[model samples]
Target: NTDVTDQRSAEEQSRYLMGELNHRTKNLLAVVQAIARNTARSTMPEAFLDTFAARLGGLAASNDLLVAQDWSSVHLEDLVMGQLRTIGADEDVRVVVGGAPFLVCPQHAQVIGMALHELATNSLKHGALAHPEGRLRIVWTGASSANWKLEWDESLPSALVPPERKGFGHVVMVDMVERALDGVVKLEFRSSGVLWSLNVRGPGVGR
Candidate 1:
């Protein structure tokens, strides 16, 4: 009787884990589908492959960290640096990240990570990372547990005008972060450059 009970317990645990894995796999696949559709919509026929591949690489980098930690949590600094490093942002340009260490769960980490990837991509293209003389500063502030605000400030050669045709980067920077993280985003135009701010709220803050 005791042996039978133990076997049943083990079987139940196995089934539960398999179900969890299946559910998470579906969720991940949905995210990838969205990325594919959006990337296709925004990229030119000649540029689609490169653009889509790079975006997938960024997403994979975030997933790599989560997998390494067993999806428990990821540090904000690590996510920021990892995403930026993908585009050689750390080595190529003047960049400063200043903030207390922040940690977020897997859901928040994925959104924030993609947001960083998009922001860094834009910076590399037209913002501070584009030129040797330009500069970028990133900072975040929050209380002990919640209400975190992250700011990405840039000092470019001159002010930037939003492109006439917006792209996936814009959607990720604004819409996706807001909707996914339940956060508020503020985009400011400055004389020197652009300021992107995100205020994160809700239950996903990690230890």
Candidate 2:
């Protein structure tokens, strides 16, 4: 009887560990999917490699934060700052971030982190951050404990024309980011600049 009980206990522990492993594996796959999908959006081979390398670096930074918390959740500020720093856009003169304090699930952190990376990249390439006299303002407000909204607006020195075609950045925001978080994304390309707004449902937010 003693031996049988020990064996059963060991089996139960093994199952528990397997469950944990599955969760981690799923998260890793999600990250890989994001990378693959975004990378596929590039048109030129050279651009693809460079963009992929930079995006993967951003994903890794977000993963580091989530791993530190045992994959529970990540702080809003940390998520935003990590993406900004990863893309080398953390400068105060060019970028502005303001939001209420809160936490987001690990999945949300990863998705939003990638979205931010894309936005920063686009800003640097074609939007406000591309010009010396441009500025970006990012703001967020919580509608309730379970709902929040974030906005990105870029101001340029002069009016600029919108792109003739939608790019990978648009796909990342409208398809991947929106579907993953069950969120709403709106992109407005004005002559003066670009504006992006995201409404998120923070269902798995952690304290």
Candidate 3:
């Protein structure tokens, strides 16, 4: 009788895990589909595969942190450092990250993670990371129990010509962030480089 009871409990746990796996699998696939669609739309046919792969890699990096933390939440510092580490800039003196850490929900984590990745990738490809005299600074502060803010500033040696159009990364930063955090996003490509900030208010900042 005891053996039978143990078997039943084991089966129940297995079923629960199976259900969780299914749910996460579906969620990941949905994100990938969205990424694919958007990447295809924004990239030239010849450049699509590489672009999609890099974006997917960014998503995977976020997922890795989530998985390590049992999918409940991710620390803001971890998210920022993980993304920067991908491009070998984590140890660069020119790149400075100073901020108050926050526990971000999975939904916000995904968007912010990708946004950070895109930002770092851009720097590596075209911004300060590409030049010796450039500097990049990232700072975040909690305004109160109900709000927080993040500021990203990149300084290049010379003025950057703003893109003529908004591309996939640009859209991801402004649109995805606003939707995820119930926040206001201000992004601009100033003469020096890029300046982007987000101020998130209400209970959503912590949640």
lDDT of 2 at 173: 66
Candidate 3 residue runs with Cα over 4 Å from true position = none
- lDDT string, candidate 3, 1-207, tens digits: 999999999999999999998999999999999999999999899999988998888898899999999888778889988888878888999988987657888888999988998899988888889999999999998745666888889999998878888998998898989987879999989989998898887757554
Give the lowest summed-lDDT range of ten residues in model 2: 198-207
How many angstroms is residue 34 displaced in model 1 relative to the true structure, after the best TM-score fit?
0.6
Q: By lDDT, who's the top model here?
A: 3
- Encode model 1's per-residue lDDT on 1-207: one tens digit a residue: 999999999999999989988988898899889999999998888998988888888999899898899778888888888888899886554899878877878988888888888888888887788877999998888835557888999998876766667688888888988998788998766767779999877555555
**What's the CA RMSD for each of the models?**
2.0, 3.0, 1.5
Regions of model 2 farther than 4 Å from truth: 1-19, 143-147, 201-207
The all-Cα superposition gives candidate 2 an RMSD in Å to the true structure of 3.0
Top candidate on TM-score is 3
Assess each prediction's global lDDT (C-alpha) against the native: 0.84, 0.81, 0.88
lDDT of 3: 0.88
lDDT of 3 at 197: 95
